[model samples]
Target: MFQDPGVGVFQAWDYVVFAALFVISSGIGVFFAIKERTKNTSKEFLVGGKQMTCVPVALSLTASFMSAVTVLGTPSDVYRFGGSFIIFSIAYTMMVTLTAELFLPIFYRSGITSTYEYLELRFSKAVRMAATLIYIVQTILYTGVVVYAPALALNQVTGFNLWGSIFATGIVCTFYCTLGGLKAVVWSDVFQMVVMLMGFFTVLIQGTIKNGGPVAVWKAAQEGSRLNVFDFDPDPLRRHTFWTISIGGTFTWLGIYGVNQSTIQRCISCKSEKQAKLALYLNLLGLLVILVCAVFSGLVMYTFYAKCDPWTAGFVSAPDQIMAYFVMDILGHMPGLPGLFVACAFSGTLSTVAASINALATVTYEDFIKYWFKNLSERAGTWISKGLCIVFGVACTTMAVAASYMGGIVQAALSIHGMCGGPMLGLFSLGILFPWTNWKGAAGGLLAGITLSFWAGIGGFVYPAPASKMMPLHLNTSGCELRNSSDILTTLAPTMAPERPALADSWYSMSYLYYSAVGWLATVIAGLVITFLTGPTRGGDIKPVLIRPVCNLLCFWSEEYRKACWCGVEHDAADMDLSGDYISTDILAMRREEPTEISKKDGKDSGDDLPGHIAEDRSYTNAGFTKDTDL
Candidate 1:
């Protein structure tokens, strides 16, 4: 049996405030959906009719990035590992700039609703299917964990049953997502982002004030060595070092910014390429603010409980429960603060789940169902999209329940996503960078990448060091100590043990930064080597024209090598057919060879391209084309 932390009993005002907040926030979603029902074109539903501005995109991007993991897990990370995790913000900053300078131009110019559509254009149908499937699986699992973490936290804090919380949250999110589509999700995310930041900063400031001041907090952190940031020892087995955090962290960040649908979908929906880039930059600013607040809150927690150590005092067992413990007990006496914090924490979970459900629905409707049905009616498609939201929502809710047994939602989610994401990123990279990679190479590389990552993850768990003396340099750190000890104790302690070894869990507990490198290397090496051995693919099968210049920059091939390999037929710089607007080869040839620059004076290309009519008719009759197969 569970007991409600008596905070619920004394704080009727807080509960009332929270309930009102929930009603208002959720009511906004329902209202938006009801009002926007008539505006349910596929484009509008999936990508906001590609007219979303920078501010909303920036806000929604922040909300999506800081999920339940950041709300609950970042504090836990700080509590367990200290401020070393802050290095991740540096990686995130680099990723934002990289995305803006590299990937955004290609995706925006392509003008596809789904970013994965670019995979098909550059690579083969098989590669696109594989990459999209990986994303779908990874996101469902990721959403399941996100939905689960907060419900569990809220269950601990508010005494609601875990299943009940999961069901309630999932149902509400699914409802709005199914009905309102991307617009509702994005706008609601803007609201949720504000609440989340307010909640975190409120607790942070109040916690710091109660702990005497920033001086006291810093002194407490320094006493506990919580402020130490740089750990530069070169050990692969260690967790939270500069090397692991930077290199591994960069790839992990790249996976989210570069490959994930939930984030990139926002970028693709911008009103212009410039707006998309601006949103990316603004997201970086928001991330920096949130990271400071979250890290500072953790330091404040150290100050508040430095002497008492409430965790050891039997107040809470798990690190994740630290924030709740602070809110309910430390800040319990304050009025309205507790409710606001709870709302803020819950906002992270809700916004992420809602965004994910929307992305999942779009992928299902566009990629899977449409592929089979060929031409489903708009009404039927809408129903199917709604139905998928319900089905996946329930499935994710169940998985969230299962996540409880996994231990540490943040680490679990990151590890699982890393395993799958590496290959997906690799596939996209190969498609964009290497035009010669055939379906066989791409598919083979994907399989190999996943296999190697799984093997490495398992090996890190089972075998920390080699049996023979000639093994590679085994520089173990405190993070890998547990796993190393566990393996040695299990083997030697049973037969001729003199004393028990102090063991950490398997290196499987290694910080998640390593997973991306392991996956990326495995895929790229296998894919490139196998493809090279197989020789260049057929020219018809290779879409060299679709490979972006930015991708080529990442490739090792020199500029001269690229030019020599292209065999003299230059890919037309101005040829873009992604809008399903095809120009015949004859027409293209007949057009002036020299570039005709369009003047900005007329405001022609600068304005939004969305049609004005509510029900605009699209004809498939340019040059006798019968079916809309371009998509």
Candidate 2:
């Protein structure tokens, strides 16, 4: 309902600031490309030669997924619902801790290039292919939504051509990611992160000042009932309750940080396992900072528009545009400030899209191309990886145009993750935590999860909840200048509750937040059932390094029992034969051999066919419990 204010709002200085973002981003790519010119191997391009620092990787891990979805969506959510969404910080903490303690140790120790590579080692090649396909689809759709966010912002504030902006953003991101690979992506993320923070602070400080100070902002939020923090309701259908946010949100984040290729690629790039752990741990702080700023921005938006009610008064087309509307209404006169915020939105897009395409390229090269061309050269591999980045980049750009028709960028992004990420996470969790889960179980679980999640997700969109179910807080439009009482009454009409939908539509009306948990639960449940019905994998058949030390660390089993639980055998026999049909011959030989023996023999052993990282250390000790080398 809001009118486009047009490109007139961005002054010359504003244009300069916006242009600088792309220039600097491209410059970083060129810098890294030149630095790593001689080392043009797939390993270097894909994971920075496994020599990245903690801070940049930490920032990259945070910035990769914290796109405009969080920047624009969180504030909109707070304004429409309440500030109780901040409780997701709890979920984030749990997600990070689990990732650091359980997931990272295995992936880093195994020296895996693709996150899905472990699926083949633990389950089967079929499982690996399935997981990789899921990841490619999930990241592409999510990147499209992320890229669309900034274009929407640019169109709202500057009346920029939407398709042109999407293409420009996507091409710039593809150029950098393709030119410099992961190094460029991570370093640019560091630069973009600063711009994003500054942009958020600008809105916060200026909006607070315009609405009188922090005290006045707080008063306005309190009057509008926008200060909600805790909700203890037990209803599963009620969105944003403490349970759904903390429990369901924990699963959502775990699906992203735990097994997603974008985050795992950055984590494994650290110079050492310790550095990787530290990077993941430090990312929690970065996530909380971005989250707090975005949440407060919502409070600030409510402070100024508390009386005007921009969406209800038909001054903004959607709730997500409220931030842009607020900026122009109050800060348009301050040249370069509005452009800074738009740049901030694009920064979010660049970091996320670059990360997505890089990860997509990695998985594509490792899972698909390597199999088709078994003897591909390292140099050719690197170039092909770069080409794949370009391909995915264009695909993401095209999808961004399609995403314009998708409602509410935030929900669409999260829903895609729930439908795809949840099943992937479940598959990985079964492989690591439940030793008895077999390849058949993993495949069945993933299929079941995806089917159920898609059914619920599509059904929800088809039969959206009634107005009564939204549970939005009170909003006022009585203070609008020159608006009569009838206009005010009409503006407030949406507040009137309607009858609840039929019970048959209950599943369709379930909270969007619960989709991830539902899919995860479905996968786990179905995986366990299928494993039991077929044949559960024995611990002796699985390599001990593949399993987390859950029984040893968390359970109170006696030493003897724990040893039996270690690899489904007693401590002395923990290195039981790994000559299973599922495992490759080199892997079986490596498991049978000792790392010290290989070291004494100058790395000449049965693992000669294995990759360098795995063959050098045989990955684990004779005990099969301790890693013999660091990644």
Candidate 3:
């Protein structure tokens, strides 16, 4: 058996290369951020001035989706659970399409800076606050865990302390985000994605060549049963059956792409609705590429070290470090290769971290602070966002330190996102679909959904044991052991406990795909029931334009309400003639003409009276509705 290579194997060149890459990427981000400062209107700062192209936006989305947890943890997942995890990609594809078709149009049409603004439009201020708060909590926790995972991997490969790595990463991310805004984030993401993909494919190719080519690698994976993708058992208790994976995984993806600001923020920054849709398609293609590369990487690693078994041999204490181990040990001697790989890993980590920081800062500034400080100036708001980004960066770093101690870092991060994401998506859906659902119902239902999800997620931790004390009904009792003989039962006996089974502490341990479903169903049912019990509101209050197009298409507007109400006034216009070209001439003609019944009946009076401010504002409004309202 080959002896394990300890952490000392990482040379000084690794650190030098990683540091240089970090400095260069971060410097570019800072330069962009400084350039942005001069032209930094609220729109530009928050959403890259809403003029991003599809390629950069798609790359940013890919970078954000493929975080450090993805880089380090995905291979570990394949190594541990076989290839069934690839089935989750189906759910991801469905969610991205749904977001492009259903969610993106509403957000773009509304012209809102933050996604949670829809909650205020559809529900009440309370629901918006609740959703934003939940997002902040979820993003911070998820970012922290993702930040921690790579640090853990680096710690295993190099001798650098995990906490130190976390601090260094957080500081670099914080600096660029504070300086640059969304523009910096997007550009950095483009650079990061290129580096990360190159590094990943390079490692995969190198590993494949070393393992006697693709044929031998596939043969080994098949021999070890690592190639199984379709397991269609009907057991909900099983972690990765086709049914559980598809249904739960779809909802999980929906929560991230449909509602989460980190991903949607990129989509909303696109130049047009068509570009946003195109970005979604590109993201789907990228996801497919990521899955294929990541799985192949794992298969190659398994084949190379089939006999040595690094974790069991004590080279690394955790499965998460397996990828790192292979990279450092196998590719260490190749000049500049280790540096490129480490740089790529750090680039992925920083890109996602920067995006998360920028998004959270935007949400906090627009949703929470601005809600209370109504008269805040534009410059003051900008400064507030910058401060918040720094504060959020530090908070995430602290959480990263905490996450380093946890098991299954990727699963934990995804689970946290899934738990909170469901309610946010449900709240948004209600806002679009059910016009009758009032603020009280929305607020109450959102609270109920969040509470239920949290309890379900934390229940086992709080309760600590089963009531019967005879093995817990829902827990798995199976065990794995190293066999000394051909008899399976005898080989597994040592690993098996006589009386009790241990609980899985990994975040992905219990399928997280179900978390979003639970939250979504709870929120929908509770919101609907509460709305029914309470009486519906009168017509004037409902804003049809603010509602989702699908919802508006299904619900008919009353003729009486349509004419008298302010809600659908814009919709009544035949050609939306809010332009001011005829303002000077038309107003003069109206003033000279007789104040007859003809004007009143034709709604010409409303059209002709153009105050100086009104004419200019209307001209701008004709350009596009300003998203300056609280909602």
Give, for candidate 3, the lowest lDDT window spanning 10 residues: 469-478
Question: For candidate 1, what's the RMSD?
Answer: 8.6
Question: What range of 10 consecutive residues in model 1 has the weakest lDDT sum?
Answer: 611-620
Alpha-carbon lDDT of model 1: 0.68
lDDT of each: 0.68, 0.81, 0.70
**Lowest-sum lDDT 10-residue window in model 2:** 622-631
Cα lDDT tens digits for candidate 1, 178-245: 76778888888898899888888888888878899899989978877877878886676666788877
Candidate with better lDDT, 2 vs 3: 2
> 528 in model 1: Cα distance from truth in Å?
0.9
For candidate 3, the lDDT comes to: 0.70
lDDT of 2: 0.81
Q: In model 1, which regions exceed 4 Å deviation? A: 1-10, 458-510, 538-545, 549-562, 565-569, 572-631
TM-score of each: 0.82, 0.90, 0.82
lDDT of 1 at 203: 84
Candidate 3 clashing pairs, residues 3+ apart or interchain: 33-180, 44-49
**How much is 553 displaced in model 2, in angstroms?**
4.6
